[model samples]
Target: MNHGAFRPIELRAPEGSVVDVRDDAPAGAHGEVRKRAVSVALGALSQIIPDLVSGDLCGTSFPNAIGE
Candidate 1:
């Protein structure tokens, strides 16, 4: 990937939102936030290029419990 090829991103999320946290927000759970971010970006891109983008990804990494 060419880092210099793309311009810097300027995101403007509402204060105290999931992506924008306060100084004393809860710790951990960054993975979940990252997954949702990717899904959102893909969804936006899908609108312009529907054929290139696939379905939304599963926004989770938790393992399901199996019954005996």
Candidate 2:
């Protein structure tokens, strides 16, 4: 991740969640994790500003943005 770009950003996720990684976890999944995080953030924001924020737009399977 570009730590410099998000220098002042602070995130507090629960332990063992997708966003929270343990030392034994495999590496090189940052991009995937980031995408899921974005989806989650947008979903949260939609609750506060439904009209302004887009919903169910993520492409990953984690959130199942588009159901079968």
Candidate 3:
């Protein structure tokens, strides 16, 4: 998985509990914080998507547009 971009998603536990998960880290920071955020996002997605789809829409296409 890419160690960048923020992907927010909602997850529900087996007991019907819902939680909001997000990757709220600044782009271009390839440190521990950014890695953790990416891991969390990926973990949440793994638990949510039965059959994950791989595509360009999964990340920020214009990463360089904002002067990062």
Query: Among these predicted structures, which one has the highest lDDT?
Result: 1
Residues 1-68 of candidate 3 have per-residue lDDT tens digits of 57655465554534321232234633343443344545666666677783672322333333333552
lDDT of each: 0.76, 0.68, 0.46
lDDT tens digits, residue span 1-68, model 1: 47665455577889788888888986367677878887998799789988776677777876454556
Model 1 ranges with Cα > 4 A deviation: 5-8, 50-58, 63-68
Could you tell me which residue pairs clash in candidate 1? none
Query: Which scores better on lDDT, 2 or 3?
Result: 2
Residue 21, candidate 3: Cα error in Å is: 19
| Local error of candidate 3 at residue 9 (angstroms) | 8.6
| Model 2 per-residue lDDT tens digits across residues 1-68 | 56554335378988766677777775455667787788888788779878776556556645333434
Candidate 2 versus truth, CA RMSD in Å, comes to 8.0
Model 2 lDDT at residue 26: 58
All candidates: CA RMSD in angstroms?
Answer: 5.6, 8.0, 12.2
The worst-scoring run of ten residues by lDDT in candidate 1 lies at 1-10
Give the Å shift of residue 57 in candidate 3: 19
- Kindly indicate the candidate among 1 and 2 with the higher lDDT: 1
